[model samples]
Target: MAADKVPGMARIAVIGAGMGAMATAARLAVAGHRVVVYERAATYGGAVRRFERDGFAFDTGPGLLPLPAVYRDLFVKTGKQPLEECVELVQVDPSSRHLFADGTQMSLPNASRAGVVAALDEALGAGAGERWGDFLVRAREAWDRTRRPLLEEPLWPNWSVLADREPYPSVPHKKLLRTRRATTLAEVAAWELRDPRLTALLENHALAYGLDPRTAPAGAAVLPYMEHAFGTWYVRGGIGELARAMYERCLARRVEFRFDASVARIAEKNGRAAGVELDDGTVEDADFVVAGVAPGVLDGLVPGTALRGADEVPPQRGASSRLTVLLALRGGRPEEAAHRTVVHTPDREDELSRLFGERPGLPAAPTVTVSRPDDPALVPDAEHEAATLTVTVPSGLPVSESAVERVLGVAERALPGLRDRLLWHEVRTPADIAEATGVDGGAVPAPALAAADGRLLHPSNSTRVPGLFAVGGWAHPGGGLPHSGMSGALVAGLIVEGPEFRGSQ
Candidate 1:
């Protein structure tokens, strides 16, 4: 059915004030819909939160933004001002500095494949660059094959096509007088990359997203390709600035926002979503409802409303959650330091085993990402610096004080004298994530991938109910800054252009 034939202007009730929800609300309002966002919290941005103390600020959610073009398109489609006008986007040069177990360190240039290859060769040895560069070529092929189906379009009826097909064109490797193609990411790393350090670099991409490289499909190669191709970015102040900009854009488009309003249930009438029932005993009627929440949360919102698509929802039992430590240093940040630094764990197998093992525990040597932005906005003065350290741990695992210390120990590799310079530190655990994002177990959702036993696939954006839609990281296209932003575009397209809409051209 065409949008014009569906009905008049719709009264859209969004369940959350997250980036995806706000993005959808802005687009739907631009399409002549009456949009209202009801957020259980007193603020917008969901997990995109910030921490401030004694004039030092730190981003507790995503430290950087990737594929900023997602938001660029959103601003272009909704209003006159582009995203650049709303926020200051700075490309992080030397995309990241990596510290390997062998004490080999290298800083890679932003979005430069050749430069990355050269840096690896210079740091790791001769022939290393060629191997990594060759792997990237195969990765690019996988990206070309799966980009549209996985990121651009909605989850199709025959999603098994994606589930069954391995898009990565893995070169045949001969071992023990047998030839076979790599299926898992670890296999690709060992068979193609061939160096422990190179394998670590390749696997780190998957590990960061909560995927176990040993089991993540070879198609997971797209993760590194997407980042290396698009480059990493930072919003001045913090990533939360992007959220504030998105919320502001929604208000400018006449989208109403109600804070501290919890949705009790989704109202259904005649097999369609009619509106929402608030916990405060109020019923707000709407022609359409958009939900930006986790799958478990959605299940409770509409009791007895069976979810459509997918046989079983992926469990969060072994999913990964982040542990962030915010440090307020009493010294100025060095001018020559890279914006981001990754300290690789010495023992990859042991770390992965601990993280994904039956009884998850902190790795003896955990891989840690340290972010130290030079922007003065994050510090009070030249004498103070704000830094954030992050590590991936099994979701719902009890994080002990020692676990927090272990993360700081790994981070100290990037920041020498970290303890001496620190005035005070704040720890944000999975419990904090659960409270902030309302995702039980605080499991951070990973981006959707083509293969891997369908463990990486998310639910369809369109639900079983006629007028209800899912629009967030937990929905189709999955998580990360770019994916969530795209979810908004996809949901808006399906609602405004009709169910027949495939995706944005």
Candidate 2:
């Protein structure tokens, strides 16, 4: 936790207790700055909350961690104790078990490129594995091109160039005597992978994040590459435990937290951010302010200020939300079961069309992600188990009772005799998420991607207003556990090292 103080340590204020905000708070405190965090909620970890009932606990947010290096770097920069010391981290052997439309099952090994290709080939056919392996090669190319700009570093001034350029080097396909390169993720699957099951498998990466493959940029291939390269990990207790560790890291670094403290607005002084004005009209002045909430919430806090330039990438809104069904099962978790299982929808086109088409509504056959962690921490005893089923749905839509039933039916593909083993189940709709994160419609933001005419990029961390900066899911690099953590590092660098900060050396 030892860090030299700058010329003069200044008082800094942070909004929210989300992972990104806490990461920034911990690092700033280590750098010898007086950091105070204000969270409107009674607890930390915004959407990364846990639901517990009758001795069964489940992470209501992200169930698995991808590219954990983001948080590892945060711990390294903040304190002497590594992230592993704070939380038990274990890699899920089989990254994921997928049940396709034809009842074909594929269990891909974690962090093994060769094993993944073999698994895909074994399940889908020899050519299926080779085609997917080829796609991964192209995906890695896209990751290499955009990794620094979209992630580690601050949003560049020439971000428009990133928006206009496609990082994915898709092979040109000859169609109707015309050559055309894949521009969208769906095209990538159709032209290159060339198998219906393979297309669904590749597009599932985007679907899991609520991004429609039909329009998601080809560079979005990096999503699966990230998981394939870094592997999927679990925090012993639950993913929520990572949030607890992060909050504790902040406290240990002398970062003060004000829970249940609401902020009304960002205080301004002579055209610069002065501090924060509380909901009760109390003003706490500081040298700089970092907001970690959604773009709309941040704009609301500064009613008169223009947060971004007219030409800057506009804040992405109303992507999609999830419907989660938490199950308390009467039987013990089978040791051989994979931690995560995805049951692909029977009809991909119909599912996508219904969810993201003209009139957005619940899909008749939604792809369901079933999580059955073999951890004693989630259950009362060895005789009981905890399981969660999740599927992306249109944000702001009313989730009917029948919709929940449909998702359960799809989940039965992953969990055999699901209803028979279920002791009780609780459903969480987007409205519940809206209540937790203050994001309208409970919509989750997708990670930023290159191309698609700047549609996927987020606003710069540094805003037009002096001494004001943005962090977390809604800012540059966009959402997800890893992206949000990286946003915190970028914001801290811009503040502590100035806007010229190029990122970690």
Candidate 3:
């Protein structure tokens, strides 16, 4: 279907107020369209939000930010300097701390291969670091080769079509297809390394996806490359700075914003998208729409409109959901440092299940995060030091006040006197997150990119519905702030210049 033409200043309505929506609004505004952003929440920035209590502050999600260039490009498009003006991000060393089942520990540094290797050598044995290096080289090669071609491309129709257009084979695709998801990271590491401790350390990397190493993709086992190559960082004040920066850019480009507007329906006429219908029965006109919401949320908003064809349906989301506990600590959390401290118990997977029980919720003590020399903008410049502890629990967990106490009880076991030290604690169950952000199942996009018959992870960013696009974490290139931001760019390109237009030029 041809895109509807809007005279003088085109009206493009972007759904959601998260980073992806902001990015699209900024881009479209720069492209000579008058844009309007609709957000249901009181504030913007879906998962990457911040909260404060008793002079202490905490970022809700996406604590570790990388790939600053992605942010820089979006800012530049809006004639802003994100790096210089919006945030101050310091390169953090020791990207993470892994606490093993036996109380063994390992720390990872940003881009510090030698340091990580040395530490692994001390914790595990000689040459284990070197083995990891070999693994990373392969991952790097895959990352570098496919990042631009496959990752950034919108892959709804079929990957083969895109592959045919490319100049060469996709290394990332090749590697990813060969990876075994059911095989544990421990099994793969054992095959590559000698020491048991080294194997455990290698398996721990799968935690980034919130998956057990045993069942996570082998390609995921190479995630450490992102840390070493790009480095882990926190926005000067908090991750919310990134979202605010995007919002500022959108506003500068004249992107109109509507908050407290719950989108109830995506109006379609004759099997084509026309505009959106708000929950309050308000109708807005638009030539094109960018849906930055979770696909499931879209399913509810538009109903059967997402149906691509008689046989086509939106893909199924993974069952593994997430639980988060945000804490404002009066005193420091000594068990961990700046970025992350992942505590693994014996039979970690089973322990995780127990933590959540039959429902979704936080585990005992779980994983903790502490930021040092805390950024005052995130909180009031206060009299004492503060910390935020995030523990990932079961997704869709039935969280109650009593459940909150139980999780806190577990945290105390890991960090002595932690419960008493808390200035306040906020528990975010999946339902709460869903209510706050319009994420279906509280699963913020990031849908598992199922392989084409166990061969490739394919995710669709383009809706079968013409003139409509999908962006954000659950779409193409999968989740993470960088990839989600990029998804917006991909949809904008499709709208501004179709494939035919690109080929002709």
Candidate 4:
């Protein structure tokens, strides 16, 4: 069907007010549809939540954004003002500072391949940088090959093409005199990077997204490549500012928002989604219904409908979630401190084993990401600072005192005298995430990957039930700020341009 010939101005009922859902609402409204968004929470943004106290604010979701072009595209397509006009976008200068377990420190420059190589060579050794740089070159190849399929385009009907093909052009290595190619991110790190610090650097990329490097497809190399190529960015206030901007954009586009509105189930008519049934039993009807919810929630909303195709149902298991500790510090942030610091876990194997193994427990030294933005907006004044510590832990696992202590201990490496400087701290566990986002076990969705037998792929935007669409981190292209924004664009394209619309050009 052609874009012009598509049906006109149908009411679009969106199930959540998350970034993806808001993106879809803004775009659909721009396309002349009457859009209404129902959010169970009292506010929009979903997991992109902000915590403010005593004039200090903390973004509990993403600390920094990668591939910001996705949201830039959304703002351009939906409104008169650009995204930058709505929210200040600043490129994080040393994209990240890595504190390796062995006391090696490396600060990677944003968006510069050569700079990254130089920094690594200076910090990790001469040839170490060369090896990492070469690996990045190969990772670029993987990114080019899989970028369209895994991200921009809709999941193809014959997705097995993506599942069967490994896009990462792994270099052959002699393992005990036998030639082999790396299949997983872990193998890629070991075979190519060789150095333990380099391996940790590579694996940490996968682990941050809750993917086990041991099992993540080699195509997962794109994760770091993406950050290095596009650069990491921060909104002036916090990442949550992006969500607030999108919410304002949606409102400007005349998209209605219903907070404190829970969708009990999807209302179907003649085998197509007609609307949603609210928890209060109010039947709000629409021509198309878009669900920006987790897979489990979607399944419950439309029971009997095979949302996951026959072969795609993942085993009943809880996905990984994040543990965030927001700290209100008494002292000011140092001028020379990096915006983001990743403290590597002292024992990688043990950490991975405990988190992903049958028996789960907090690692003795779990990797922690500490964010100390220099922005005064996050502090009571120049004399105080707001910091956040994040670690990936198994979903549904209780946050114990030991776990909190471990996180604080690791973060102290970056912020010396952290305990003495801390005025107060608040821990946001998986339970908090579950309560806020409504995802089972508070499992954060990982970005869609190219291989691993479709194990890492999200469900298609279009479902078996006609007129029902899925958007957000839980849908096509999967999670992360960029992926969620892309999912929104894909869903809007599918609705506006019809199925013939392959994807964004």
lDDT of candidates 1 onward, in order = 0.90, 0.90, 0.63, 0.90
Candidate 2 per-residue C-alpha lDDT over 1-505 given as tens digits, one digit per residue, 9 for 90 to 100: 1121123688899999998899888888998999999999999998899999999999999999989999999999888999999999999989899898887898989999889888988898888888888899999999999999999888889899998999999999998989999999999999999998888888999999998899999999999999988889999999999999999899899999999999999999888888999999999998889998988899999998888888788899768999999999998888899999989988888889877888887767789999999899999999998999999998887888898899888888878898999899998999999888989999898899999999889888888888888888889888999999998998888888785689866
How many Å off is the CA of 384 in candidate 2? Answer: 1.0
Q: For model 4, what is the C-alpha lDDT against the true structure?
A: 0.90
User: TM-score per candidate, in order?
Assistant: 0.98, 0.98, 0.85, 0.98
Clashing pairs in 3: 94-109, 111-228, 184-214, 360-397, 446-473, 446-474
TM-score computed on alpha carbons, candidate 2: 0.98
lDDT of 4 by residue, 250-310 (tens): 9999999999999999999877788999999999988889999987888899978876667
TM-score of structure candidate 3: 0.85
Off by over 4 Å in 1: 1-6, 309-317
* Stretches > 4 Å off in candidate 3: 4-9, 160-186, 194-196, 310-313, 332-336, 352-373, 379-383, 400-416, 447-459, 500-505
RMSD list, candidates in order:
1.6, 2.4, 4.9, 1.7
Give Cα distance to truth, residue 374, candidate 4, Å: 1.2
Better by lDDT, candidate 3 or 2? 2
